[model samples]
Target: MTSSLRYWKKNNLTYVLHIPPHPIPKSPQASPSKTHVPLRPVSPLQNRTDIVVDHTKWGKILGRIGSESIHIPKVLSKADVHTLTAYIAYLTSSGHPREVKELLWALFPELNTSKYPSNSEEHSHRALGRKGLLTTYRRAIFLGPVFLSAVLNALYKSNQPILADRIWTLAKKAERLSWARKLLPNVKPWIMGPHAYTVMINCYSSLARRQYWRMVLRPQRLNYRTAIASVWGTLRYKCQILPRPLPSHQVMELMHDLMRHAALVVFRRFMNLRHDYAEIPEMRRWLAEKDIPKPDARFFNAALRAFRPRTPPMRKSWYRRQLRDAKFNLDFKGVLPNSNDGWNGSLHEVAKNMIHAGFPLPPGLQPLFVGRLRGFDLPVVHGPDRGPFAYRPQKIHPWLRYRLHTPKEKGLPVSRAYPQFREVLAQRRRHRRSRKRQRNRRAEQDAQRVAPKVLSL
Candidate 1:
């Protein structure tokens, strides 16, 4: 539940808007963990007719609520909260971006709940005392990792970035309550775990990818793609801090399993020249670890793409063999055929470069790029009869390639996520400094203005 407190000076009143948590719905990629939400079976009649009718009816109902302040005659109960969550999930999944804002508006972003008892078993309709509400600094957080991750996923799939951004912003801001003194509890689950941040990152990556394909014939905007990379990088560094952040490919698999699309992040990493050197070995070791969960073949396929000139022949052959033998990867999950890479074989000449560069190729694969593959190659994927980029591969620049080795602690070998992790620290430092400057400037201006008042007094 996302609950917030607001003080209204007009009537000397404060309201705590408490939105309760909803049970997780069944999804195609729904985790094996049991969900509180019950499965509702749909017959063909309901699926084709009833669902459409209900979806349309709700769409109309939501549309009618334009900018109007809604009044709940009664305090929302657990049942009410579940209903709201279910409706939101249903509407969101139905692709009804139309009046979703109105639906969101109905979420009680500004509910007056101060007079009610905080510890009350029920959401009381009657107003109560103020002192109790004012004295207590702690706020209840009902938004769990499970709920938030699901909600974020639904919002993104529904093309509700604005709502998604607002949720993310709220979750991020909950880190610090600048207005009040107390810290929030259990906030990390909302923002960090469950790929909540990754959902948004994947959204940006998807957009960037669409732009790349749209501009294949024309001169693509390099800076635009660079900006997208920077944004996702900053978020990964700032918002997500796993003691052991999974490598980019694992993150990519999580995305594919969740969203059913190939994430460009994996491709971008594969195309990085230095990626094969630093990241591939780390993946190999990670897979070899007995403690880690059984390796997914999709993950193995991703590693195969990381092969480059510097990669040892033996290791390359071994990776190919691992991919070839299905038994090695254990039980395979997710969409059967290459949905992770959107079922596309070519990206920035990776397939082509690997073949021509003397790297072992998995069965029935060929090179798609010509010349020296380096520095940000735009994927020129086409239908059947596909050829290489016909020129040398243009890979993303290796600015971070010139690194001085610094030894680290024992566990979890430093993989590709290290640079972004480092950047994230610097990014936080820069943010703090920037904020300090703004705060000081505001304070100085206030002092300067107050100086004349002091002199006059």
Candidate 2:
């Protein structure tokens, strides 16, 4: 018998069976051949002494990259360690911009450096360290708008308006106007400009559209939309509190300019097909309340360009409106198509050049311009079509062109008598027959079950 095999005594039977040693053997001093070996513990903490804790090299690298003031765990739990390992392993997996701020909050709740007062002089200056601190910082640009506002104030106090403007641009891109509204007072005359106001109005309109879409899709989440409304209200209230807020007329002028220059941003949600013609009255009423005038043909044309042709009737109505608007004089805004050169050029400059070059009037202009152009017999300038300035045609593959252009008759093989085709037809016929029989049987059984009993009674 092998040395590892041993016999165990029971009642006095002559049978033999192999037996293993005790799970925890005696000490080495007690037995030279066998020594005690530690068994697996029921609780993880029971074997805590056996486990070694160390900072992950990559985690250390990330720590150096992220904000030093922001806390990152030195020793992670098993779950956190597993999560960190997975995050590292699948490094290419991406998160949406909307979730970035939430992720920062989830990872580190104490990342409120912006909440500190700016008047702290030296201590505040030290806390405000390098801009690179936020480059890899766990927090997102949107959530750091307050931090940006504070930084903008500091930049302005230090006579760095250009840097402050750059920061404002970044905050605008992140769509954090709620935080940005706080900086408007300090920024002063710059924020009162038409361009800045246009951007702000566009931001509000975008938020309104987003909230409106959410409210439509989820009636139960109405509170979220309400909260967005409250935020807007808060913004307006803040403007009122400003020592020198832009006048109400200036606000109206800003809206008018935005409607003329960037109508798509203002009217898309209100005018799109997802909203019905029945809502037009409501829209008009709302516009009147907001002191926004009815849009001209140019504005409608810009707005309609953004609409998908998914609904033919609504799209047809939009085209009709565009035609009606074109009956008046055309005073176009923004860049004309087909010429990238004229974008930076002023309206007067473009008109002067067109007069000098004798180029035909651009489309989407009023009928009067068209009439004048037709009468002049000017050379037609075949520039890009007038529509949404951002629209670009998607490139299609040559190989897939056949699939798109192929006729129904050509889609299927002409060889219908092939074995595979025959098999398919045979299966379909069998399925049809089976279905008919099942229906007939069910009918007969149901009729019999429903029939009255006469003689049996």
Candidate 3:
């Protein structure tokens, strides 16, 4: 027993052998055991790679994707409308009255306003008042049954003639004629000078309506005096009045009827006169009949000499010996003067005939005779080539080579003489300096690469 106990203690045999087994108990179903699965650790290098990809390339892709989703709305808010309205109002109130009216009309079409609305009596009075047409605000407002009393009160109270004139001028530019006419009467007294009356008549004349002219002439209706008075006034002021005066009513009517015929006759006479000067015999006869004074002897001789053809007179046998020692050709032959007699008559005679006939030389020839006489050289340039040195010299600087080749020749530096050359040298030096700096940088980089860094503990 003792040995068995010792053996049990030594080997734990009893606990191992103490299995209680009886009748082979049925085996229970085996249960599965739970097992723990360890998680894999993320690498620091992998996190760095992800950040680099996002920062370098993927970040751009994400940004573009986000930007594509953005949208902007398109509607003008109340502030925008107010701003536009203020700008338009400011532009309208500042001397651009016509444009202001136009813009207002465009904005409010229901105003039933025409730029010149003759049908509206209130508008007509306003237009007239603005143009300074009425003789007085009271006359415009009260005298005329079709006037706007309230508007006249406002315009008359303002009583600014200069401003009214400016507005009237603007109205004229806008073709508000009826309105412009309204201002005529009131401004007439202020504009009593010649310029004023002329402008008034011109305004009526430009209408091209005979009725308007008659209206202006009639003292009863338009209040302008007689046509003669109008002309006298114009002359007093040194102004040119049109519709030239006629000697009689009969002549005026006759001229009016024959205007076209008169023009045709005048044109035909002008053309015929232009052709008459070309015929030499006819020109001389006309000059002789006119009894014109002759030109001075010197002038006549100069002109005659110009017309005479050069006959190589120096080359004649007698002159040959005289000029033989000279270094010029003395050739002579059967050369004779040209027989043209066109310029023989005195210029004075020609001029008198031209004056009597109410014609002058064609404008082209007038300048020839009236201007410089440089072109009046003796028409016939004769004689041989005159001298050995007839032609001008060709070689300009023959001494330049000798000066350049001299032994003591000191050369000027190109940069000293030419500023452009100095600039070029400066640019070249800068380029060399840049290259040297780049080379130094590369050498430093190489040295750093070859050198070793000591590790700190």
Candidate 4:
């Protein structure tokens, strides 16, 4: 509905009234031409579309920053790197992992470069190349701990432990030990989520093992794990004030896995010193006090395998006892005799090692070692075998089960991808703003029409 107003004044009196018309409904598609921009409405069902759009927007911004040169570190200043950090965090939170990888790739194209030739001339070039790569890594570190932690988590989810450790080293170098110690607890909810913690555990443990091997092979260089351990030792001591039992039970399983791996790494390192049986009991007590997950059979097997000797040491009996205790613990605790995942062969290998070491096999463990039993024994008889097989379907939690899987989201409509149409669209926006003048002129004409009516009245 619309109304027109008219006013008339005579001497000391004035009157005004408006002629009104009945309300009229406007058409839904009335100015379709003006509303031609092809904006896609995000569907709540598939979040990936929204993630892609946001990633694309930030990626374009980063791309523009890198457009000046191939050397991204040289091109982008510290402020720009900080800005990219927020974008990285957002991508991580979205859970659309590919976008994060793509954004990283866009910014760091040098990661894809292959190894250069090995000539002396090329050696100099290679050195320069290494220098350039280090500079870029410095830029990545400038993104700060939060972003680095997110990258570490993503790398772990993608099962790239090697890259995760490299990033961890880069993070340590970029940020001071004191700063990380102070910041880690505060930023943990966002940066040190379960995935990040798991990756950290994996990184520390693997590095510790590598350091032990290096000491065995080349004692000339100081152990690499010692540096990491020193930093962690300080952090752990400072972190005594941290609350126990993390908030999300959803990730408790993963958290336990992390703790178990960390425990094994520490245990393995201690055993590597002199096949120390004392360290095992101490480790158990230490882990218990720390509220870390108790070490499982796999942990014990890993420790045993690490000490498998070419020539038997004086503590051979002690090592055998450790294996026996591990077997006893496996039986006592009723932990899975073998891993559910087909990938794990450590338990079997350790059993064979024990047999070869002149140690008597634990009763009934021989069948498991021989591959007769796969895992937990189930009371099922398949076909006519009537055999108790080691197979059982796991019970999934109600929250973990889902009937609807998220469908993949489609990208932007084809119309927006055309350059000519985009240019036209820009021109249309300009003209749309210019139409304000026409609207003003129309207002002026309406005022003139009302004035003539008022004069006649």
Best-fitting candidate, scored by TM-score: 4
* Model 1 TM: 0.27
Listing every candidate in turn, what is its Cα RMSD in Å to the true structure after a full C-alpha superposition? 33.0, 21.2, 36.2, 29.7
The TM-score that candidate 4 achieves is 0.28
Global lDDT for candidate 1?
Answer: 0.40
Q: State the lDDT of candidate 3 residue by residue for 331-414, as single tens digits.
A: 243322222412223333333333343332322122223222222212322233332443443332122200111111133322
**TM-score for all predictions?**
0.27, 0.24, 0.14, 0.28
In Å, residue 401's CA in model 3 sits off its true spot by: 79
lDDT of 2 by residue, 1-457 (tens): 1223212224632222223344443665664355444332223332122221224565444433431345689997665434533442233123222333343345434333344322234775545533323332323332343443333334433443323334444444433322233423222111111223223333333332231111112212223322222333223333343445556554444433332333233343222322332344552222233332222323322222322122233343454464355433243532222222122222323233334433333332212233233322244444343434354433321122001111122223344468898899999999999999999999999878767554356
Model 4 misplaced regions, further than 4 Å? 1-87, 115-121, 172-197, 203-457
Candidate 4 lDDT: 0.44
Q: lDDT (0-100) at residue 444 of candidate 4?
A: 100
Q: Quote the lDDT for 374 in model 4.
A: 35
CA lDDT of every candidate: 0.40, 0.35, 0.31, 0.44
Number of backbone clashes in candidate 1: 15
- Answer with 2 or 3, whichever has the higher lDDT: 2
Ordering by lDDT = 4, 1, 2, 3
Angstrom error at residue 141, model 2: 11
- Model 1 C-alpha lDDT per residue in residues 1-457, reported as the tens digit of each score: 2222111122433222223344455786765443343333333343232233223565445433521357876765555445655766676667764455565444423312344433334545322323333222122134333444556667778766546655554444442232222454333312134245456555544443331211111122123322233333233333233354545554554433332223434334334423333343453232232332222223324333332222233444554453444333333542132324222443334444433433333322212121223321343322232224343332322111111112232334446699999999999999999999999999999999999999999
Which of the predicted structures, 1 or 3, would earn the higher lDDT when compared with the native? 1
lDDT, residue 168, model 2 = 47
